[model samples]
Target: MIQRVIQFWRAINAHLSGSDFDFINIYLNKKEQNLFFAMRLYDQRHVLNVAYTARRLAQKDGGSINEKLLMKACLLHDVGRTAEDIFLFDKVFAVLLDKYLPKTAHKLAKYNNSRNRSFWKKRRHALFIYYHHAAIGAEKLQKIKLYDIAEIIKYHHAPPKYGDCRELIILRKADSLN
Candidate 1:
């Protein structure tokens, strides 16, 4: 644990030099991230940064503006990385998860779309996000009911229909760049 802490601190310090340390400090305190997790978080932060950027760019391009869904998809795209103990396994499990249960995943992605919206309303988007976290986050999210948030996670990687969801496009552009 100590080694993990040291590793995490050094890695984050290197990767996130310009980050909002206030937010990072609070996040570290709240999540108690080990060094490994912290490092992973740095990577995720970059990914999300790109995703949100693309989202903004997409808005400029006349696509629908949905910051809530973009945030959900961008942030949670990598939450699943926590599942893999090995680097190669991460890709493998992700592929399998998508293949075995696409509808659930897509629905979960939509749920993620509603997370921010639900904050102001009663309609939660938990179920959508939950479906993709392999039953764990899904159940918890379902309990909390952030269907949009869950759906964002589920479908952010592969949104429903072929033409591409605006949020998914932004997320993909961000994922590619980040």
Candidate 2:
């Protein structure tokens, strides 16, 4: 509960400094950077926090972790939530709906093809994106030939199972922390 409030406050005040861009540029190339920047500023800030937390978790784990790949995956984990698909209000609405009324949220998340841009469809689309952003992000990354990173992003939100990769575990932990 406290963590959620802290995250909300941080989101409202999210901003990136010049050095943050320098950090991002270190892990992402021009095309990847474009995708990263396409997200809203709050989402950009969230990914940066995820990347930083992921690196610290990797350092603590002290295994044969690919730090570069981990950093890249963390930075682009939320790349699916672009400005268009789910804006600020949609994201908040989806979060609250999922938290308070998960059954309803699940029903809405199931996508139905509709040509009209009605309010209900917008809510449904937001829930769908919220639930499946990882897979959506993976597809986008695949289009840009980021197969390895896409694989990590693809399962970032999946349930933990036996033989999960160290990078994926770290990314999930970091994401939850933020």
Candidate 3:
């Protein structure tokens, strides 16, 4: 509950600081930056926070993680959820719906576009993006030849299975916190 409040607060006030912009430029190349910037400002801010948290978590892992790859993975984790797919209200609605009524949320989370202007279609699209952003992001990364990073993003929201990589673990932890 408190985490949702924090997330809501952060979403409303999301913006990029100068240093955040610099950090993004340093870690992402031109193509990567395009993908990152394609998201809404709120998501950009969230990813920046996740990247910092991931680096801090990696530091405590005794140098076993690849910081660069972790940072890149964190920054581009939500590239699948672009500004076009969701808005501020839609994000809030998706979160609340998924939290209090997951069954309904699932019902609305299918990918369909036959009735693009229908009320249900709008809600469905938002929920779809909410639930499937990780896989969508992975496909985008793969298209850009970022297969290694794509694998990490693909399972960022998945439950732990055997033999998860150090980077994926760190990314997921950081993502959950922010």
Candidate 4:
């Protein structure tokens, strides 16, 4: 699974870069390079689902967010999991709570409820790999001055309920399709 995911990531990166690593990819490599590499494995149809959904919702809602940006957020949302298991984020989250976050990051994990914990906690425990990663992803987008795109990242988890923009709606749909 790890190797297969790596191959998938390589294909997408090859498409995006058109040859090799870009300046941004290079910088990501320096920090969390594994996450950058892992992004290549994201399913493209799932990515397109986000764009298509965003387009559909945008017609009803308002403005359209960047399809590419939303897709990128969907693909990269779970990259943090690369640090934990390279295949799934839930195991990574558990490992983080047990060893890293409290000691290294000096933070304690807080969850919504037992049901939510059982739901999301078991899915991706060690990394910022789920809904919250949407917000985390939004922060990254904000750094690039794409706050609207960031909002898409922020709401991908909740969809129409919390998703305020067309792009976020798209992201949620794409994620759901996956």
Return the top candidate by TM-score.
3
Candidate 2 stretches greater than 4 Å from native: 110-116
lDDT of 1 at 41: 50
lDDT of 3 by residue, 5-100 (tens): 888899999989999989998999999999999999999999999999999888888858888899999999999898988887888899899889
- Report the alpha-carbon TM-score of model 4 versus the true structure: 0.43
TM-scores of the candidates are: 0.47, 0.93, 0.95, 0.43
Give me candidate 2's TM-score against the actual structure. 0.93
Q: For model 4, what is the error of residue 114's alpha carbon versus the real structure, in angstroms, after optimal superposition?
A: 26
| Model 3 alpha-carbon miss at residue 42, Å | 0.6
Instruction: Estimate every model's Cα lDDT from 0 to 1.
Output: 0.47, 0.89, 0.91, 0.46
Please list the residue runs of candidate 4 whose C-alpha ends up more than 4 Å from where it truly belongs after superposition: 1-131
Q: Global CA lDDT of candidate 2, please?
A: 0.89
Q: Lowest lDDT 10-mer window, candidate 3?
A: 111-120
Candidate 2, RMSD to the unseen true structure = 1.7
lDDT of 1 by residue, 1-178 (tens): 3544443454355444445344334333333233214325554555446655766677777856677556544554555434222232233333344578666545444333322364312111332323344343323334446565555545554535776667766666666554
Candidate 4 all-Cα RMSD: 10.4
The 10-residue segment with the lowest total lDDT in model 2 = 108-117
> Which scores better on lDDT, 2 or 3?
3
C-alpha displacement of 29 in model 2, angstroms? 0.4
- Which lDDT value does model 3 have at 19? 97
